[model samples]
Target: MTKEAGRGHALLVGAGILCSRLFGLVRQRVFSHYFGLSDAADIFSAALRVPNFLQNLFGEGVLSASFIPVYARLLAQHKQEEADRLAGAIAAALALIIAVIVALGVLATPYLLWAIAPGYTGEKRELTILIVRILFPGTGILVWSAWCLGILNSHHKFFLSYVAPVVWNLSMILTMLFFRHRDADRLIVYLAWGTVLGCLLQFLVQLGPVLKLVPGMRLKLDLHSLHVRQVGGSFLGVAIGRGVVQISAFIDQAIATLLGSGAIAGMTTASSINLLPVSLFGMAISASELPTLSRMAGDEWSADVATKLSARLNHGLERIAFFIVPSSMAFFALGNVVVAALYQSGAFTRKDSYYVWAILAGSGVGLLASTFGRLYASTYYAMRDTRTPLRFAIVRLVFTVALGLASALLLPRALDIPLQWGAVGLTASAGVAGWIEFHLLRRKLNKRIGATGVSVAMMVKLWSAAGLAVLVACMVEHYLPLYGPIVTAIFVLSTYGMVYFGVTYLMRIKVCVEVLGKMMRRIGIGG
Candidate 1:
């Protein structure tokens, strides 16, 4: 593909993901309005994580790594029949496995809660168990939704698949909106049911598109195909790697359980904001690049594969840094404004916003690393080398566990600080671990692909632009009279974005120029 096409694909994915993420934020805002940092909020957050464990293990990251390369290769080779069979077999197999797991998970909710939220006792513990059971089956359905995503993404139908989650978020938002008057405990249970319905809606919305794309698809577990076996083989390594990453998240949540009532909920809220850029820029670019990268891996590019791969990889890295640098800075420098804008209302207080901002600030420590790391990992997956990422993920888990324990459990007491501040520690320590894993992945990939990454000068330029943007945004925030959070965010963030892009445009950055050109064309101001 040409450079222009690649950027266009990334933009489509970003636009779709942005829509889904916006609705998700809206969902969270509604939830925060009703639930805030109450014990009920903690219970709902913890319960949600239990079932999401299954989704994460079986969902986008795992499927993209294991299935997309093989399936996309078949499509590239014009072997549509084989690709259809592979997709059918994998979907059927996943459905069967997830069914059994969801059943077992429902039965094991009491036991699972022991690890996920050991600090909860009596009513809190019982309520979490009930909600976890309520949520498990829905997550199973969402795993099927992810299967649809793999198919849609491989077919280059990027927008609908990414935007499908808007329905899910809308479902929950509507549920909360309808039942806003209920007590927190009852409302949360209703929200869980809404989530289940939303999950089903999310799956159905994507299924029609997937079916049209794969008209020859037949659902059966035909494990005999070589491509099928290859995907399964790759799946194991990627699953383990994804599981390692999820384990770090679970461990952090588990530790948060001990930090008092609001820590888990606060971290979840902060994470929602922290993940926006990761999904919008990092995931968007990486997801769009995967199939293209896989297609490039074929015999057509046998000669000069290294040259092409290195060029594409470096370009991806540069694109990721351009947006991510400012995003990370915003989280560190003006996170409270963001947190307030998105989440502060009703039951959620200004103090709550500050608390979440602290965690977002910690998250900023490795935001760029994590985003860059994702594209690197995607490159590894495109090469069909999954074990390297698995090994590095395990190393990250180790650091996360060790540092997480020290920072979250011990450091607060040592510093004579409130226990809740430990939630910030949890995020910051994880960021450090993310950087470590990033370096390892980049170092190894460089040896194989010949030194692929954003250049030193590009880094200097992006970071300098981001720093100035943050300064301008901060000044605007300080001088502007407090309108409501939303209006304030509009002005402050808009200024920040315009300054960043304007400065980069002045610096002759290619992406800024292209982006501005696209905008001007959309407005009929440019040819």
Candidate 2:
């Protein structure tokens, strides 16, 4: 793929995901206004993770990592009929699977919650069960929506696939806006129903484009289809790989649940903020690059293909780092400002804001590695090698779970940290594991592609640039003229970005220089 294609498509996907995540931020604000970090919020956070398994199991990540490369290659070879058949088969299989899983999940909600969050008791447990049942069918609909996403993305229709989440986010926002009452419990019920409705709407919205791509599509059970079986086989390994990550989250929720009220909500809110940049940079870049890489991998192995793949992979890695390094710095330095600006209104007090920021800062430690690791995993996907990523993911998961337990369950008592800060410990442990994961991913790829990633010199440069940005931003946040948390944060961050871009350019950071030149040419500014 041309650098232009990779960058442009990433921008398209990024723009869509950015809007969805922005709406998601607004949704969080709505939640904060109504719920804050109450037991109700904790219930929602923990219960949401349960239904999310349905989404993650049959959702975008697995399909993107396993199904897309094969499907995209078929399209590239002009195998429209075969590709459509595979799509239909997968859809049918997913529907069947989701039907069974959802039924069992709804019925076994209490048992599932007991296992995952054993500490939840009485009303909290009851409320969590209620929400999980309400969310089950909706989560099933989302699995289908993810199937639609796989098809749309393979066709190079990136925007609608990612943007569809807006419907889901807005559903909850509207519920919080219009349906709220003095009864927070009743409001939680309304929010749960809204989630179900949004999932259906999101799925329907993507139907038009998906149907256009596969005009002759129809549901069929074809276990005999080679690609069908390949996907099924790949799905197992990929699902296990993805599941371990989910289990890590589950472990965190379970452990956090033991920490009493608001811990789960605190972690949830912090993670949502952390995911903002990851979705924009990491997921957007990988999703855009997947189709191109799949096409390249479909070709016969050659030195030419190896050279091109290595270049594209390295470029993606650097671009992700260019954005996420500063993101980590910002989170670590000015997280309180960010938390207050977005969520410190209404029931969300300043203390609560600081709590969420602590978790965010801990999560920031893994921002670069986690984002970059997604790209490296995609490289394995392109090679149709799901097993390798799974192995590495297993290793990472072991470390994460080990460190997460120590921090969440042991370290707080031992070190005399607050129980709430245990959430921070859980996140920090995961971040440390994320670096190890990325290292293994890059190492394996480099063994084949040869020295194909960010250099240590550039790593230092990125860190230095990010560190300087954080220093300036922190100082301005403290001393610069501003209105309140929101205004102060905006001013500090905008100044930080301007200073960072100017300095990176002056320091001959090619990523910033190229991006700056693009913006300048686009708006008829400096040449």
lDDT of each: 0.92, 0.89
lDDT of 1 by residue, 48-165 (tens): 9999999999998999988999999998889999899999999889989998999999999999989989889999999999999999999999989889999988888899989999
Q: Which digits, one per residue and each the tens of the lDDT, describe model 2 over residues 1-527?
A: 68888898999899999999999999999998788999889988888889998789779999888889889988988999999999999999998999999999999998898878898888878988999999999999998998998999898889999999999999989988888764888888889999899999999999988998997678998999989988888898889999888887787788898987899999989988999999999999999999899898775888777888898898998898889888999898889889999999888999999999999999998989899989888888888788888988889889998999998889889988777789998999999999999899988888877678888888889889888887888888778776888888889889889988877888898889889889989999986
- Where does model 2 exceed 4 Å of error? none
Give candidate 2's error at residue 36 in angstroms: 1.1
For each candidate, give its TM-score against the true structure.
0.98, 0.98
RMSD of each: 1.2, 1.2
Q: Give model 2's TM-score versus the native structure.
A: 0.98
Q: Candidate 1 at 331: error in angstroms?
A: 0.6
